[model samples]
Target chain A: MKNLKYLISLIIGHLTVFKHIFKKPVTLEYPEKKIELNDKFRGEHAFDVEKCTACGTCQRVCPSFGTIEIEKEKDENGKFYPKNYSIDLNKCIFCGNCVQYCPFGAIKMTQNYELADEKKSTLKLEINTLKRNYFDNIIDK
Target chain B: MDYLYFLYLELLHKWNLPDYIAMVTFPIIPFCFVAAALIVVVIFLVLAERKILAFFTQRKGPNRVGPWGLFQTIADAIKLLCKENITPEGTDKFLFTLAPLLAFIPVLVVWGIIPFCNEFDIISFSINSLLFVVIAAIPILGILLAGYASNNKYSLIGSVRSVAQAISYELPLIFVLLSIVVLASSMNLKQIVLAQSSIYPFCGYFVFPAFLGFVVFFACGIAELNRCPFDLPEAESELVSGYNTEYSGMKFAFFFLAEYAMMFIMCAFIATLFLGGFLSPLGFYVGEKLIPNEFLANLSVYFEQAFWVFVKTFFLIFCMIWVRATLPRLKSHQLTAFAWKVLLPLSLLNLLIVCLIKAVL
Candidate 1:
């Protein structure tokens, strides 16, 4: 009776696995097919230049020291704006602290997670790259 | 083979060539055919396992190499060929070098023992089924030598487990084979197949009478192949790839090639033993009905026989892969216990049943 039960379960297990053959595969062909990300997913940082008063709250609130750098400058309208704002992504741990603690809503995280690069210098996102991330997210939405 | 020799001799006679030339060249044709067939079958079997396993897990398998990853194994073979052959230090150099060849060569001989179709049994002889069992066990020696030469504790342990597994499983395997031999009343594999043929194709299969033997043989075949669920020898978590751990590049490729080739041949052997090998399950040959030209129809029947052999072999292979995908590795003690306690008695019972049936018939 024990052997019979074992044999029945073995057959059941095989039949269960066999049924999976006809069902649709859940794998995405990585390069060709991209997975859908959540709306509030924290990926690469997107900077809104228009909203920034350059108070450098993101630089202070960031958990990793030196992950975010803000260089303040005076524009022709005499308002503070960032001149050489660069985020060293190598140090950034995607903690979302900068996005959470921002006073002026100047920075946000976008769903642009393909941030791998060959060089450390390339990984550091500059003002232009950050601005592009913001625009890209907008276009994505 | 006699037909082939006659045709070759006739062709030589037409050209005023010597009969000795035909004799010399005829043997090479089957050797080349077996070698080519081994490569093709092993490559496709690897791809099939991966594709089928992926399907079982709800994932897309290797679709990047070629259309549906058809060239994936070919590309892998090329990659293995290009890699440097690295022999580690503190190893017995001579035995380490010879081990893979020792493991692989026996499989090539075993492939020839299988009667593929009516006229294509490459190395036919009386007691050829017994010969299959003898030659198949030789790879264990190569594996044991590999572990001994590697100077690695893990490899040694793995090889030791393999020998134990082989010994225990071999009894049930042979007992099942004994039942089959009794039913067929012949030890020659070709004769065994001929014995299975009747007016009703499917009912004529030995699988009907020796169904218990079939199940036992299939399990023993998996254990002999050291496949998944019984794959304690190469248990990745414990042994880090087992007896071939110290081998790399083309040497490692030989071990890999031998394994897949052995799997194909083992499935073919099972198909021959139980499933009415090369016999059309539909009770008639398709070529005889479809083809109008007598000579072409005769030629096509040989190819069709070979086709039926492959179809049955691949179905068995699919079941093996399914078992692999479903089950986890067995505990070492459980493996041996299953063989000795569970399988041994079952196979003996199967033998008794077969003998009684044969007597009654």
Candidate 2:
């Protein structure tokens, strides 16, 4: 009777495993498929050159200094325009302060968070690269 | 035997090959075939085990290497081959070097008597059952040599555990095998399989009458192979890979290969003795009707037989993997006690029952 009990337990244990052989695996192949992130996910920053008034509010709100840089320069029309704007991604902590504090809505966080780079210098995104990366990830359709 | 001799002569006549050359090369060819089959099967078995374990644990394993990780073992093989062969200081260099070969070669030798398909039998003997028991015992010597030569305390402990495990388990295994031998009334593995053909309705396998013996044999076989639940010999959490702790590169690869190859051999042995060998579970008539080729039917019939053997072996292996995933390792004392207290008496009783039945019928 004890032997029969053990044999039944063994079969039950095996049945539990055999059932799993048919179920779809829970592993999402990361490179081919990305998990959907929530709307409030603070990721890489995007800069809009046309909307920025260059009030430097984003720089002031940033807890980590040297992360957001706004340089002022007079354009051909003689108006003070932001020039050579840069975000040092190494120090940026994906905090929404820059997005929250920006007066003209110039800096907003995009959902593109694959921010790894081989060189530290490459992670320091210039305004153009930031604009491209942010817009590229947006599904227009 | 005479037909096999004539087969060689016929082959030489067809190819116009010299008699002396044929005589010299005839014996070595079987080993070559076994070795090739062993390497190929081990590679696939490793991949299959990883994939099956992954499924059981709700994870994906080795899918990046090839299509569903089919090439993962190949990549691992390449990596192991390229790694530096390191011999630690204060180790017995000669014995350490020889240990993996010692571990590997005997497992290969057991394949000689395994009748894969009907026509693919390499060398069959009347005492094939005894041959299996004897060859299976030889790997412990290699394990002991590996442990002692490594000069590591952990390896030594692991090897000692292995020796103890092997000794304890062999008794139950022998009893189980002896019962089967008595039930079939033959010591020949092929004849034993043949006796099973008409016993049951669908499969006619001995697993029906000798189910207790099958259970004991399988449990002992798992212990003999140093697998999970009985894997105290190579318990990674406790002994750091057990007896093969100091081995690396191709030496470690050899040990790994030998372990999986032994799993295949044991499963095949079980399939042969109790599960109807290479006979289709649906019986020969169904398999023959499916082929329906009067001219090329013989070849197709052998193919079907080989196919059934493959299916049964893999099914048994999958069960083995499932048990590995579900169970935890047994403590050394518990492992030995299970063998001596639980399994020994059970197997002894099974043997007596089988002998009495044999006497009556």
Candidate 3:
């Protein structure tokens, strides 16, 4: 009787696996295909240079050290503006702390997540690249 | 084969060549045909297994090499051919070099023993069924030599487990084969196929009488092939690729070729012993009924017979793949225990039932 049960279970197992052959595959062919990300998905950061007051809040709130850097210079009107801003993607863990803590909402995460690079130095996004990211992704959307 | 021999004789006579030359060259014709067929079939069988297994797991298999991944195995073969041969230090150089060839050559010989169609049994003899069993066991020695020479602990363990598995499984396998021999009443493979022919083709199949034996033989054949669930010899998770661990390049390719080729031949063997070999299950040959020309119809029957053999063999192969996809690898102790405790007794009972059926018939 036990052996009969085992045989029946084996048959059921085969039938279960056999049925899966008709089901659609869940694989996304990388490069040519991409998955739809959620609205709050945190990927590469987009920066609005006009809204940023060179506050350095993003650099302070970042969990990974040296991930965000800002250089500020006072203009003739005595308002601080960023001389240079850069984000080292190697150090940034995509934790969304910078996006969460930014007072001016200048730094936001975009859905452009294909960030692989052959060289580590090339992954550092300068001010121009980050602003372009905001224009290409945020403004266009 | 006789037709080919007569054609050769006519050509030789016209060319003013010796009769002995014709005799010498005639055997090469069949050898070339079998070798070419074996290569093409093994290549396609690899791709089929990959595609089927991919579908079973809900994934797209190799579709990059060519259309529908048709040339994937061909590209792989070329890569293996071009790769550097790596023989590790502290290994026995001679045995390491010879083991893969020793493993591969017997499978080629066994392919010649199978009666594909009525007129195409290249190496048929009265006791060719027995010959198949004897030749099939030699690859185990090659595996043993590979493990002994490799100087690796995992290879040694894998080969030892393989020998143990083969020994335990061989008994039940022989008992199953014995029941088949009883049903067919002949040791010649061609005669076995002829025995399965009747007005009702399905009822004449030995599978009806010795269904238990068929199950046992299928299990034992899987074990013998070192396929999944019984694949202790090269358990990838446990032993890193097993006996051919240190082999690379064309040497490893030889082992790969031998394995898939053995799988095809084993399925073909099962089709012959139980599923009625090259006999059409339709009760009548379609070619004989449809073809208008008498000589063409006679020729088409041979092709139709070969087609039936392939269809049955591939069906069995699909079942084997299904079993692979469903089952987890058995523990080594459970493998031997199942063979001895379960399969042996079942096969004996199957033999008894087959004898009763044969007597009644």
lDDT of 3: 0.93
**Model 3 TM-score, 2 decimals:** 0.94
lDDT per residue for candidate 3 within B251-327, as digits (tens), equals: 99999999999999999999999999999999988999999999899889999999999999999999999999999
Taking the tens digit of each residue's C-alpha lDDT, what string does model 1 give over A1-141?
998999899999999999999999999988988999898888998888999889988888888999988889999989998888999999999999888888888788998899888899999999999999888886466
What DockQ does candidate 1 have relative to the true complex? 0.82
lDDT of 1 by residue, B256-342 (tens): 999999999999999999999988899889999999999899889999999999999999999999999999999998999999999
lDDT of 1 at B355: 95
Off by over 4 Å in 3: A73-80, B14-16
lDDT of 1 at B234: 93
Worst 10 residues of 1 chain A by lDDT: A132-141
Among these predictions, the greatest TM-score belongs to 3
- Put down candidate 2 lDDT per residue, B18-58, tens digits, no spaces: 78887788778767988998999999999999988999988
Q: List the residue pairs that clash in candidate 1.
A: none
Compared with the true structure, what per-residue lDDT tens digits does model 2 show for residues A1-141?
Answer: 997898799788878877887888898889998989988788887777877767788889899989988888877887777887899989998889988887777777778778888999999989898777556654341
Residue A130: error of model 2 in Å?
A: 4.6
In model 2, pairs of residues that clash are B200-B204
Per-residue error at B250 for model 2, in Å?
2.6
Estimated TM-score for each candidate: 0.93, 0.86, 0.94
